[model samples]
Target: MNRLPRPERFILVDDNEADNVFHEIMIRRAGFTGDVLIFDNGLDALAFMRQDELRVPTCIFLDINMPMLDGFEVAIQAAPLLEGRETTVLVMLTSSGSPQDRERAAQIPVISGYVTKPLAAALVRDMMSA
Candidate 1:
């Protein structure tokens, strides 16, 4: 079976510094040799996403709770940009395991997945292999 292409860019939009560091390390441990962009808030991440030179096959890991804009808000605004882009995967990598949060994420067509904190290398590998 042919494996799916690994994402060329990994974008992490979370306010927690420690979580960002952990997630980045996890991505590297997964043997993903790609650009990893870390943003402390949703606005910056959205700005980078809006750039014309943004690479394809990008995976965005967004947190649910934030100061300025939350993950849901970002996903809603990003839906237009992500439309028809099969290579782009926007996932909610939040600590919240609430059913309400998951349901909200599911309502957003742009959001590909909703995962809890501490992103694992195995999951990353599976994402790449899928």
Candidate 2:
């Protein structure tokens, strides 16, 4: 595994705890030696992102089908928080492989890309290298 330049911090917003754990492992496997903040829901993640004391994370792994506010909704709502944070990238990590979902995510300027579930080290490495 090759080491890539890591961000100051990383954010994972997914309702599934199992996926979060798996994604964390994948991130580590990809050699991302940075803080990983896991949020079970979008609302909390958005709140944390909006906090003045909070540093903008390098990457945000967001699941699209969360309870309170879905990934699409968060992308729309997070526009303000994302502004001026060009280094921060938001990737939609969801189980849904629907083309409709991908198209919808494409419409959202906040979303950098859409990825399927069960994040892997290779994918993490690719994302980091990008």
Candidate 3:
């Protein structure tokens, strides 16, 4: 199977501090030696993404329920920023398994995947290999 190159950066946007920490650990355990950025809210993550010097081949794990802007809102706003950036992966790493949520995510062109919460090392490895 053809595998995409390893991402140069990982961004975690979620309100839960514990989840962010655990996800960061999992990413490291998955053998990711690149930068890991954690944001407690979506607005901050968007701000970082809008920076002029943002890097490519970045993976963003976004949560569905967040204050100031939900996952869908962030994804919508991020679409333009991610335009033509093929290596950039935006996955909804949410706890909600609602069919509505999944369908909503599916409608977003920029969102590449939807994963349940408590990101695991194996899952991270799979994401990297994809």
Candidate 4:
């Protein structure tokens, strides 16, 4: 049994439902014992984030492309909400291979890593350790 947190809180921002399930499974199998919060759109995620009552996750797996407020915009908005809180790891979880996307993700101070879609256990482990 995983002796870690019963439900390792994670924010998964993918538009695809299957992708959500896959990552959720991968995360748990990776030894993360937390609830994976799924959001299809960055604006929806951002809306929840604006709520002071919203709980920040241990990490965020953000999708670069989404309707209404893409990952870049979400990152911009999420920064202030995360102020005064501990480092909540943010990583780009997307299929986007654009050099510009990488550059943009790098520019976001809150974003710790840029991960490709279909998050694997190894990537999860690396992020957890980082």
Candidate 5:
């Protein structure tokens, strides 16, 4: 994969621990040498996003289905923190490729893209460029 601009930090919000591990490897393979912050749930991720004063994430890979709060809920709640923050991108990363899900993502202003899971290095490269 071609090199892409590395974000200061990459945030991954997924309940699945194994997926987080795999995605981290993919991000690195895409030549992203930055902090990879993993969150098991949306609430924690929302909190982190709200509290972190220093840097806004370069990219946020959020799962559609998760415990304690789904990705949509997080996006909705984080919209205030995310709006007009051009450098930050919120992406829906999930196993489901349902059209309904995609439509919902469209309704959310914060979501830049909706991608299926098992994140690949190529996809990461494409996303970074996007």
Candidate 6:
């Protein structure tokens, strides 16, 4: 089992405030010491990504639903931008179980995986190990 080095970065995108808070808490409780960036919408996250100094998160947890630039649209826009940086991984975290939702996520090259809502410690462990 190859574990990732310490100080891993994570970016979580979700419209719901409560979900974001819970996710953050879980990540911290897991003993993963790193910056957990939160974005309420995709546009803000994308904007931050454009900044030269913005640390590229090790993994991005994006929600399928959002106001002003949804998950799919964000992926479509941000994928190319992050391509030049090879270390980052994008995962769609959504409550959606629809095949169409998963299919849409699959279309984006930047998106590495799709996860259901309420991110668990196991999910964090697996993603960080990747």
**Could you tell me how far off, in angstroms, the CA of residue 68 lies in candidate 4 after the best superposition?**
1.1
For residues 42-127, what per-residue lDDT tens digits would candidate 5 score against the true structure?
Answer: 99999998887635447888999998788999999999998877668788999989999999999998898888988999987766
Give the winner by TM-score: 1
Q: What is the TM-score of candidate 5?
A: 0.90
For residues 17-75, what per-residue lDDT tens digits would candidate 3 score against the true structure?
A: 99999999999999999889899999899998888355567888999999989999999
Per-residue lDDT of 8-118 in model 6, one digit per residue for the tens? 788889999999999999888777788899999999999987774534446778998999989999988997677755557778889999999998888777787888888
Model 3, position 24, has a per-residue lDDT of: 97
lDDT agreement of model 6 with the native: 0.80
Counting clashing residue pairs in each candidate, in order, gives: 0, 0, 0, 4, 0, 0
Ranking by TM-score: 1, 3, 5, 2, 6, 4
- What TM-score, over all chains together, does every model reach? 0.93, 0.89, 0.92, 0.83, 0.90, 0.88
lDDT tens digits, residue span 89-122, model 1: 8899999999999999998988889989989999
What ranges in model 6 sit over 4 Å off?
Answer: 1-7, 53-57
Which lDDT tens digits does candidate 2 get at residues 1-130?
2222356677899999999999999999999887899999999998987784445447888999999899999988988887656667788999999999999999887787788988889987776675
- Pairs that clash in candidate 2: none
Against the unseen true structure, what C-alpha lDDT does each candidate score?
0.87, 0.82, 0.87, 0.75, 0.85, 0.80
Predicted candidate 4 versus true structure: per-residue lDDT over 11-117, tens digit per residue:
88878889999999999888887677888888788787776344434577888888777888888889887655563556788898889999988888777678777
The alpha-carbon deviation from the true structure for residue 89 of candidate 3, after best TM-score superposition, in angstroms, is 0.8
Backbone clash pairs in model 5 (N, Cα, C under 3 Å; residues 3+ apart or in different chains), count: 0
* Deviation from native of the Cα of residue 104 in model 5, angstroms: 0.5
Candidate 6 worst ten-residue window by lDDT: 1-10
